[model samples]
Target: MATPRSRGPELEHDVGRTPSLGYEPAGSYGSVRYLEHGFPNPLVRWHYHEEYELHLIVATRGKVFVGDYIGQFEPGHLVLTGPRLPHNWISTDVPEPGVALRDMVLQFGDAPLRQAAALIPELAEALPLLERARHGVEFFGLSEAARERFGRVRAAHGLQRLAEFATLLDLLVRCNDYRLLSTVQLQSFDDDAALAHISGIVDYLIEHYSESFSMAELAQRSGMTESSFSRNFRRATGNSYTDFVNHLRINKACQLLMETDRYITNVCYDVGFNNVANFNRRFLQIKGMTPKEFRRQAEARFGSAA
Candidate 1:
């Protein structure tokens, strides 16, 4: 994957706070808000908010960062991230004019759903799915349907919009072919400064995973002591510095293995591992399969030629 260019000037100015894009139409849609934006827009960045986001990639293919999990995404890639889980998608391939509609997003709060579930037992069925989304849930084979449902919700108002939103949730709740992207569920932090600090570090790691760096260097950069950095990092991301880096590298390796016919050894080195043996060991530990096995399985599952 090619390195993503700078995120432009808007992101540099507002990296941590959520963009106030006139969320949730008044007197109608209630808690759920529908939003769609193209690439190179100000809304695209490494940030978090107190809303569960159902995000669908309608255009472009590139790296997606959700917490410490880094992976490739193409058109139809659909994921739901729970409240306050930092995430971003950087498209590596874009035409000069850029994509007109790169993302379809539905943002909703958890409390409203929980309260509704309390009064309406049937609505409680979605609780498990919402809990799973806290770690970032990627639903497979639901992109087309999700896009249509999002449109219906977007076009409707008041009760009609709420019903359409619930319909989309119902489909997601039934999907079994899904994976939790992040290994650990991030704990909420009371300190906004600390949250922003950890989020900035995560963005740096995702963008520069191939480059070499150490916890000491990161601590120095953050102006925190080495031990303090480690503790806060673990608290915010739910992974030790080493483990988080490994997860990021392994995820990138999986993307390459599935998309390219590169040699396993080369793929290993390309994803920042130094040796084949160590790479194989770590791959097995994380993926429960060898890189060769992973490639073969991916081809078999996707019906793609090796």
Candidate 2:
């Protein structure tokens, strides 16, 4: 067993072919892999695999997309996504773009966990935690402790790595500061295959979220009837088309508020809202506060950090 390094990039033999949503991590060394990624890695795209992932945002503030849930993320943030849940984290420009280490990740398959749980009563208690991870979990409290465990796990090997992994899971399972992200269950392979085409449409929306596109245009592009596309899109993403677009707009609005001194109205329109009143209404619905309040709190947080 080899000790993991802080700056260890993926070796050439450590990668496998990527499927539509994401690639399978090659478990060449062990069943559990501690992988790190910089900002500009190819794995940054929206993707999924059979291996469950425990991810830590080591640096950068960004908007994370897990299923239909879009929210802000910063350093020390920890999230767990179960097998086959599509997700991506897009970094904002607060810390510049050249940071080489943005994420510390761990990927392991469920079979080994279940096998171990069958023999260990305490490990069996973690089954519920893994079940809950099907919807994705963002841990809030125990952050510092969890961060320390992540560092330890990243540097350990052999039995030590497995021990640290179990400790990390125990902390997360008992923590009260976690929230389930997606509203739906894990999608089947066929469902994911069907949604692979929809992933392209999602990519387009992410790229051109501020621009307006007609339902007919989207339907034509997806080669489905408007009604059929709407149904499938909701089934895949857990949001209506309008609500999905609004979430994207609001996420952009959050980035602008956190990073710039722009007025709330300008920020709203810059993210594609046609009216300040509607923007404010939707923003409050999604974020639980007025844009002005959000900006004030964000500024306070950053200012204190600085």
Candidate 3:
């Protein structure tokens, strides 16, 4: 990991790791669309991007994760995150009757945006917003005007997009009410070798559910001693090595239960659980439902065919 402090101007990470990924640096405007979807899953898997990101949640309530900080989210959230900061959005309150989940995301690569800050001292002042946005950059005094200014981003034109993004960033800088998610600069998740090791560990657990794996083995794969690897992995993702791998397993198990034609026993085995009984227990602990029950509810919510 190229050292990442929790709070500072040095926050930047690679974009290849993100799930809801999209970029348009090759275009004339070099602007990109930031979007979030309701399908596949309600959670945006924890990941980081290389681009400077400014997210404005257009609707609903949720929690934002930047590094280690978490906060109740509401509409009109205007956040600016520095490059490579790890973050994600999780909806806490689904929408009301007849309403769909309201979400939005915007991404911008550093290429076209190369000298955007150098050209504007105002943008430079907003660098703190990037640091603050790691743990979600909670907004207290900026919401009203930010909410008003953010609507301009949908202008559907190049110059308009730039102007709206500029407006959004400016609003965040002058706002007095906000806090950072992590205390250190967050560009730590950018190392390709480290990420490769992390990704391998994640993929390994996902493929082998019922088997037992140890942190030592994971560290060996990453070419680090157990303790050093543990510390760095946690620092990189705000998740302990074992806990993150467990979460990954649990997540995969839930997905299988929710969307598959396989039986519960089969699903458990398919997800790497040798102990079906234990699998049930852990699934309930994390998902609040047994495999059969989860499948039933998932059918009702998204359609059995889903």
Candidate 4:
């Protein structure tokens, strides 16, 4: 819970119209793949894959964006996302740059679930869980036993990995402390032309979040009129341009306020807000607390900022 250092040159968060599809090759052992990533890495981008993913946040706290849903996450945060659902987590409290272990992820294809169901008919009952995962599911307050189950899966190998995976799924399928993210099913496109324009725009905005731009400029870049660009952006992201930019700024401010020693006034300007009063208002609207209160509470929980 230490305050994250100033984001500096790092991108605050990632958002793109076309979610990048990720591929994980099956290792010599099994089809299921296990991955652990440290912060300030390249994988923390707005992307999706054909395989379903079960993700665990092992360290740090941050805001998680899955499809159109926006929320916060901390250590032990667990989420299951079905194929083609876009998701990313922006760590708000990584005290150093380089690398910090922050996530444990398991990814597998629907074929395995089908094969398991065919071998053990009763396993078919769990198929609904995969269907529900299309919208992404977040399990809150994982029981110690559940966490232990996740650890077993992470530590297992070969056939044992497969077994642990089944056990973990069974435990989660029966749990009721979870909620679905993504209010609706998002449509997918195979054509790169359809996504490239908006994706470029989103990438640019994320990289240059602290700067100001205009609709005319963005529209020109996208090869669309102002009205059409605005309409499509909202449709694709579920956020208007202003709100989308604000979301990025506020989350970046959260990291700076908690991790860095910068003054609130400086933090506000550093994150791209022109006025402290307006920054305070937007921070409260997004985080339900003023910057000072947030920093204080974070320190209390983490035993003082670094």
TM-scores for all candidates: the values are 0.58, 0.54, 0.48, 0.52
Writing each residue's lDDT as its tens digit, candidate 1 over 1-306 gives 443233211212223323344244344457787778787776776667778999999999877767546578999999999887767788778899988789889988899999999999999999989888888999999988999998898898878889999899999999999989865444558877777777788888888988899999998888789998999999887789999999889887876775566778778888898988988999888877788877665543221222
Write model 2 residue lDDT over 1-306, tens digit each, in one string: 223223111222234543321333444337677777677566766567788889888788877766545578988889999887767777775445557888878888899989989998898988988888888999887668877887898778778988898898889878887788855332223566558757778878888988878877987898889998888788766788888888888877876765566677778878999999999999899877888877665533322221
Give the winner by TM-score: 1 or 3. 1
RMSD of each: 11.8, 12.6, 11.8, 11.7
Please rank every candidate by TM-score, starting with the best.
1, 2, 4, 3
Segments in model 1 whose C-alpha atoms lie over 4 Å from true places: 1-28, 184-284, 287-306
Best by TM-score: 1
User: lDDT scores for all predictions?
Assistant: 0.79, 0.74, 0.58, 0.72
- Model 1 weakest lDDT span, ten residues long: 7-16
* Better TM-score candidate (1, 4): 1
- Residue-wise lDDT of candidate 4 within 1-306, one digit each (tens)? 334365222222213211222223334447776666777666776667777888888888877766545568888899998888767787777886644567777777898778979999978978878877988999876645656876787678888988898888887788888887754222234545635676778888878888878879999988988887887777665678788778778867766764587788888988889988999999888767888877665443222232
Q: Which model scores highest in lDDT? A: 1
Better of 1 and 2 by lDDT: 1
Model 1 residue 69 CA deviation (Å) reads 0.9
After the best TM-score superposition of candidate 2, give how far the Cα of residue 112 lies from its true spot, in angstroms.
Answer: 1.1
